[model samples]
Target: MTAPVAGTTPDRPLVRTWLYAVAIATGLAGAAAVVHQVTGRFWGDLGAYRAGAVAAATGDGNLYQASHLTPDGIALGFTYPPFAALLMQPLAVLSMPVAVATWTVVSVVALVAVIGLVLHQVGTPDRHRPATTIGALVAALPVFAVAGHLQVGQVGLILMWLVLADLVGGRHRRWHGLGVGIAAGIKLTPLVFIGLLVLTGRWRAAATALGGFAATVAVGFAWRPADSAWFFSGGLLDTDRVTGDPRTVLNQSLAGAVTRVADDPTPGFVWWVLAAVAAVAGLAVAVGQHRRGDVLTAVLVCAATGLLVSPVSWHHHWVWWVPALLLLGGHAWRHRHRTATATTVGVWVVLVASTSWVLAAPGGWDLHFTGLGLVYSNLYVLLGVAGIGVAGWRLRQPTGPPRPATVDTLSGSQP
Candidate 1:
């Protein structure tokens, strides 16, 4: 870990007290926001999930066919697997308000845990007061996106935490890939992480992830054979059916950007070519980082790749940018690279300024891909590309092999 910044030692107690106060204040504010949201007409995205769960539980209709309107009456479809509906069945039993409140609290906690895990992965655990303070401040840069997802009751943050835990958790445990498998079962994007494990040469872990995913499919099949057949056979590949307009400013993936500019009968071919290039380049960087024993960096690189390659990576899905920013800032800080640090901070400013809270404001979508709107819409994809560049550059530099990280160290938690 890097040394504490000058003068921080004498003020350690005061700083700790201030941090505790800030944490409590933030939590209270978030809780109050949740309360207001529940009382008001905003159920955000939870309506879709809850409606699907209700359909599944009652067997009243096709789970995939169920759609719920927002308070504004915009119909939202349930795009997840049948198994996801099954998983959400318990929440379906609760009243809407209760379910919303419960989900908000759980998502908030998951967000906090993700911040902690990211900080630890970047070598800034709470035990290091100065580093922890810096991490907290840096972590705040992505709060806008996180809070946006929370307001919508989106599952992005929870999915992010699951992937982080699977990468950094339970190194000694046999089922290291179980979390990734389960998350993938709920939403298919996480299946990329299994490829990541394979690329990093964790063959056993890769096999375990594959097995777990198979188990999830089997369970879904047993529970709803027709739905499973429909989804697995073709429905899963139909991005247009699952997600909304690909040209929407909210989608930050390569396909989204291409869709905004192209009028081809099959623009998907362009997307596939771009995705192939990104996957090869990004995975190469991740594999290099892993070989160098920087597992955290490798994991993050793979995550960014997943977001970039996915057909419709919503602005909320870029929540992984939180950790990516922290890791880059930490690297720059530790190396005392002023230019790099400035660039890192500049990226954070850009991302935060372009958050869904800002870009998705009333009438903002009307702006489309005009001028600065283009930059804002494609920010996450650009960031992912930049990450790949950084990884490649780092791989070329000369350095000794990193010290072997223990299972506990990889887990990012105290034993």
Candidate 2:
């Protein structure tokens, strides 16, 4: 007799797609109501309009022009190459609320699409459903918290997608560089992936990324010489003014966390040490796994490492980790036994479910809720630490022998 299966696999992909559609829709609807309920929301919305207005009214470069006055301008404002504003400038003409709302939709869509693409790449057909479902579920919580910024045409989702693309398209080295270039041009942090490519001996990728970086800078400066000067010399170099704002609580990065922990001590040295160590360790892991050709693993490793090691990751930024969670969760569910996928899934589910409630709660809730939020936050941190530990453990374990490839009857490629 055939061996009995443990769990039934339903039509997971369709179910997953449907679940996410509902979850994201619900999040948007809820946020709209919350924004409407806040008495001072109009004022806040107006403020956003004014910023974009100031940016659009004065010139194409107003927001950027302001950044040039500061040192970190190069790194802030999406820290992307100048081309990012190409699309955003038009939004300036619309009412602030309209512009932001439209952009949030785009970001949400991009995030979902990217995660879906990654899931398809790494998962078996049966696994896709759960992976996508979990992705949507995790995304709803973090994306809602960071909804305010998404409305402003921020590129976090886009950047995260591009990075994931790099890992997924590893077999196509050119595509890897292209994704990295696009991401770096949109945001500087993704350039860190260049370091990873180099460590992996993908010299071509490094060269392509570097060339793209230089080319964009050259073209951006060529297009607007004055703005470029301000952006490069002053804006790119300074982080103090860019990061000084107290409202950037969502960053929740190491630097931001330190700031939260103590109002005074700068702790600059500690933050640098931590970031450097993370980058080095993470790059090492990615390079070691280079031969595996698992794009999902590379992307997750990079993102998780960045969040854990960065000094100022906010909860919204956690949205980037959704794919990582899904990948881990899907892998676990697929294996279900030998791997710690179930444990990983449980950890992520608890963290995400609790986080949404705490984040969405209006201030002055009961002490019990407040206490629970604190406990949950602590739990979130611990899980993050534990995740890094687990990833490190997985990395140390030898990569299992390659699975036998099943020939795809349609494409002739190995599935």
Candidate 3:
């Protein structure tokens, strides 16, 4: 079955009203919990970001060299680019509770905005779009995560929103691709989007992205020369900044899986080989979707590629799956695969609902896992790999040629 055109589905006002009510209740409750946790985590990721900015702004010490200990004894330092520290300088100015509260609200709004953006790109019509989006978010509760991230104060959703806006909403604009470059400056994962720009034949945008990224790098070097040099030179290689140990269950990257399976802390040749293969395969899937004229799916796969190939894809980074499944379920629903879609949604709910337990599994013991423990630990990575395979398999061997792939099929007004 072909995908449904925008006007094909009828809307139900009662359904929309109920979903809106549920969404508001659930979102506020979730935000409250997230804010509470963030407030309690004094030396957590927000702390790192704030501390890093205060260091850079107040000249306390080297941003790269500084480290703070958590209550549990894990040593974390400011690991993001110098540009990020500068950008986050506001965090250093606000009181901790106010900063955490404000950040939580901003993150929640960003995630909802990202969801709305994805739904728009997926061609969900205005009549039923709101219900469909809130329904999906409520169903995928963790991904909804209204006011905060499960990982506490991560900027991944904001970056996702920035990239999606550039790709889908700004497709026709000359300033396209600039958001992605700035995002990469904040966190390097979105850098893969520049390559997606190149492969999808947006060469000028690619150049603009590269130029924007270069400008950020130049700014970093200008403001914090020594820290910038250390980071750009070798500090980036130290995975401990973001991902302490590759073998840890929280690291759901291809290299992480390989290291856990191979029992190597330093994960050398095999990890590289696996990463290379996954990157190539995932990018191939993305390019194929582009050729098929589905820029939404193409951009998402490129995002997935970044997650899969990075040295350590923290479990929270897996939130990208929310928009992904929205698109995928749309395809399946239009195809009338009701049972398959239900099964997919059920699996997602079960896995994510148990995330608190799974995340807590690494608490008492060393990170080594075996047997089903390995599967339990790497479930997200496995699911991501499976998602790439399914996406590739769903495409026909040949569709209409590169039909000027654009993300504007039924995107309403920009979110």
Candidate 4:
């Protein structure tokens, strides 16, 4: 007789499962549409970019230039690099409403797909189906909200999915690296992952990313060398000041929070020192975990650390955590009765609640009141630190991988 697959176990009830998934997805879609129509924009950053691109295309001239109005300015289109502008060409051709709507839907779908894959990998037999659906739906709401609010996070969702897929042995690691590198060329923050690849001994993946970065820089320089110079000379430097402005409330980074707190100029050195120390420590921990063959943990820790340690980060950027969140949830479901499972669930609740509350808060509070953004930003930082701490503690514990004997006993085999 053929042997039963170990740990395959049982599945969830199909009918109820599908219904819940569909309802959640529909709700998210409706919310996205409602927000879009009411705001006359997708979300935050997205609205700014879509409007700026439209302005540029309409002969309104380069909106990133200082000559442009604050509402219309691209905020250093020069810093955007040519390939980024090139990537937006299609959207530039389309109407704002059409582009924003299309982008929102596509990003939402991508977020779902990534969550589904992560759930499948680590989910419990009973929870797999429901968790897959619910996680995706949960992630989608914030995803759509962010997109509708800022027009960012779509890239984040894509990058997170790509990195997870690659680490999970998908055949397209290089391609994913390339895509993320292009995103880095446009956004800068994604560059942190390159350090992760190197530290984790992924030489080939690192090479692929390096190649992609080079290619983007070359193409960008070739297309508009002057723009490249302008970007590096003025835009990158000015980003600090522009982002520090009280009106740009969307920034959720430690730097942004610090900027809001200072009455006059405080020592920038202090903030940089904190960020640097945190980053190094986080990277060391993540790399050590990766060396121990905990790819999922490594990725989760590193991704969270990247954002937490960055001098500048926005809430929309937190979208990258969807995969990690699902991974933690799936681990809980897979080991529902265990101590680790309880810890996982507790962390999930805290992180999810904190994130949801912060995202829903107004950007004005994020910009004007130092205390409000400080609370949100510090909450994220603390959670990230605590999570890595928990993960490290778990590692030190004597828990072993489930044994074949346990599987045999569970399956009612003679022992």
Candidate 5:
């Protein structure tokens, strides 16, 4: 066995303290901005969230009736659950600068937490753990998904943190499903975690998740009855809830790729067939990984499945890809002696981290493209598909791999 590295775990408390000080200072700055009613022209997705919360908090307008224009000059609707708006009421109180500042700070903290938890899940050596997580966080800085989240003040980071903490932290076992439930309330994507809990035979936690979700819906209805009713009745049921054209490269879902390939505004039958295949195959692989003591892989498979199945998966929505890449890196390192597997995983990691394929593509992302354009536009979609295939293959491999440093300890801690 390798010996521990110097000046690593011993300095954790100092690193943690420094992190706390930064967060406190940032929070104080945000509070000052709110008190002074500071304003700026930093319109982005956070503006929509703030506006939605304003409507929800002040009842100035209908939440679902019409899209609201922000200082940034875009008419965007609040495309999240009522509970999310309720949670963001604080943003309604914040100025644009404060909102952005606070959000950036929060997103950074969550990102760090996610990296640490993921490294823990994989049993990264304690000596290398801090540096690895810090390095991973720095590496994530330029990734399109992560950068997009910080730029637009998206909630993806916070939601990812909630799920990982509840499932992998080993600190909240008694309240296992609460975080998943709350995250699902904020955005519907995390609902997949509840299914994961069920599949993993964590029945009590799954029920708690559903129960928590029900409570959120109840709160939404209580606070804004008509808005909640309308949202759940139509917006949640149908595919379109201000989601842009499915053909756009911004949409990295399987449906997005299918629409582009078939040149259909709505690639109905084929999209469903492919989605169904992905769901079955992906879920099976996830279950296999979980049973084989690889809970992080299972979680990532579920995350990737949600991205593929959703009608719209914006670049920022791929935040969980951070952890996915970490796992891929670990796998590549362990299998370095095996040329094919190592090279494949290493190349895949590069592809996953590089955002240039989509960034450098020609304009008119919504318009149809031929030949190489299709590859550029559908890069992430294809990656998701291929990732599932790779996972399935790994599951079936007969190699007696080392037992995973899985999250079962955390799960088992749940009462």
Candidate 6:
């Protein structure tokens, strides 16, 4: 028998094509499922946004005071910043059906873009067909969660893309922090990236983020002074008003878990303590990854930390896990040790499976967890904790002679 030729894999391209075909097919199916589930109905959250936008554009009642109802008759109110309402003014010009359809399409596109971004950042080198194919397949694991967000016209996917774009483009752009700032203006969660930038010694980017955020605030104040004052003076701090109940099964933040288990009026204190510890440990790991030239990993760590520390993190907000899973899976696929590979891939499998299950389950703030429900409700927070633990473990491992710390733009030859 002839020996296999070295440095050649003839079937690799064929395998890659097959993988791409499967991923595309699966994504289309997921989109179909979302449409079937939603059936072109008005989205509850998007209704609130639309109402706010209409109010802002018409100079009617205060945007914050505008009351909207979901198709199901649930009372919904605008909870985002004044700038978010201003940004939605264009949608207000359209009829309800048209606005919902347009927003849904945009959201679906953003979801696809997020998947492509993760694959590009964590997949094998551009020259490695097999690795890239595997990355695409891994990227599909979170499609169900993405579809859930799309069905409701949730903004999580767009926010995820904004953060990823900033991280991916920051190395090449002078004003890298602008995207993050704009995203934070729309929703405060993305402000966490600014802290990550500061921790990573990207002071210029941090300043840019602050400036962009300030500009948004200024625009809001100039355009609608009373609404801007309402948000900044009190609305922003009223998590209960913006997010409903922390005990909601959909809220997977550390605070949510605490709220579920603790009945004390002072549970907020406990959450604060836990959040502080998580922030310190998670940010420390992020700093270490940055110093090791693994900027992507560091960013994921910080993103996960943000989810955990937030007062309310809906299940869709955990979309950051898409990139987290890809990064971990890629590392596992490249490792030399079978045991390590199995363990890493096992974690990815567990997380992906659990996320799908949770998204499918009936969830509400009034619901209480028992038995498996506890695990299901706390899945994302546990994943965040596990990610931080993995970072700490990596820090302890013996390292080769340190190469000069340089950003891993996540663009290079295959490992």
Best by TM-score: 3
Write the residue-wise lDDT of candidate 6 on 119-193 in tens digits: 455544446634564455445545545545655557887887777777753555777899889999999889988
How do all models score by TM-score? 0.85, 0.72, 0.85, 0.74, 0.84, 0.81
Instruction: Please list the residue runs of candidate 6 whose C-alpha ends up more than 4 Å from where it truly belongs after superposition.
Output: 1-42, 127-144, 263-266, 336-366, 398-415
Give candidate 1's TM-score: 0.85
1-415 per-residue lDDT for model 4 (tens digits): 1124558643234345545655654555566666656765334455445544554445454445512123433343223555566565566676545555566665655565565555555533433455456655665464422333334414566556556655543423335456556667766667787888888777787777778877887886776575566665666656553454522334545565456566323428767886787788778878877666666677787877787766656656676556665666666555565776676556555555554544433443444445455565455556666777776766676644631111111111212
The number of the candidate with the highest lDDT is 5
Clashing pairs in 3: none
- CA lDDT scores, all candidates in order: 0.72, 0.54, 0.72, 0.56, 0.73, 0.70
Instruction: Return model 2's CA RMSD, one decimal.
Output: 7.8
Candidate 4 stretches greater than 4 Å from native: 1-34, 51-63, 66-79, 123-127, 139-154, 169-176, 240-242, 246-250, 257-267, 337-377, 398-415
Q: How close is candidate 4 to the true structure, as a TM-score?
A: 0.74
Tens digits of per-residue lDDT for model 3, 1-415: 1223568852354345435644564555465556556656542677778778888888867997666567767767888889999899898898655566666556655666667667666556666766676677566556422222534567777888889878766777888989889998998888899988888789989988899899899999999999999999989888766765688776778888888887777889887888899888899899888777777778888887888888888776777777777776766665678876986686577456546534554575336778977787677778778878877986876563332223432224532
Q: Which sections of candidate 1 miss by over 4 Å?
A: 1-43, 129-144, 263-266, 356-361, 364-372, 400-415
Q: Give the lDDT of residue 100 in candidate 4.
A: 54
Candidate 4 weakest lDDT stretch, 10 residues: 403-412
Q: What is the C-alpha RMSD of each candidate to the true structure, in Å?
A: 5.4, 7.8, 5.3, 7.2, 5.2, 6.4
Write the residue-wise lDDT of candidate 1 on 1-415 in tens digits.
2224546553453355346535644664466456755565555578889988888888886778888776676777888888888889977898766677677666755665666566565655345634564455445535556656766678887888887777764444778888888889888888998988888778888888888888888899999888889899998888766455777667778888777656222447889999999989888898898788787788888888888888878777878777777778767766789988998878777776765535364865632466666666677777779878988898988864453242232124343
After superposing candidate 2 on the true structure, give the runs of residues whose Cα lies further than 4 Å from its correct spot: 1-62, 65-81, 126-153, 170-173, 245-249, 260-265, 338-342, 353-385, 401-415
Q: Candidate 4, residue 87: CA error in Å? A: 1.2
TM-score of 3: 0.85
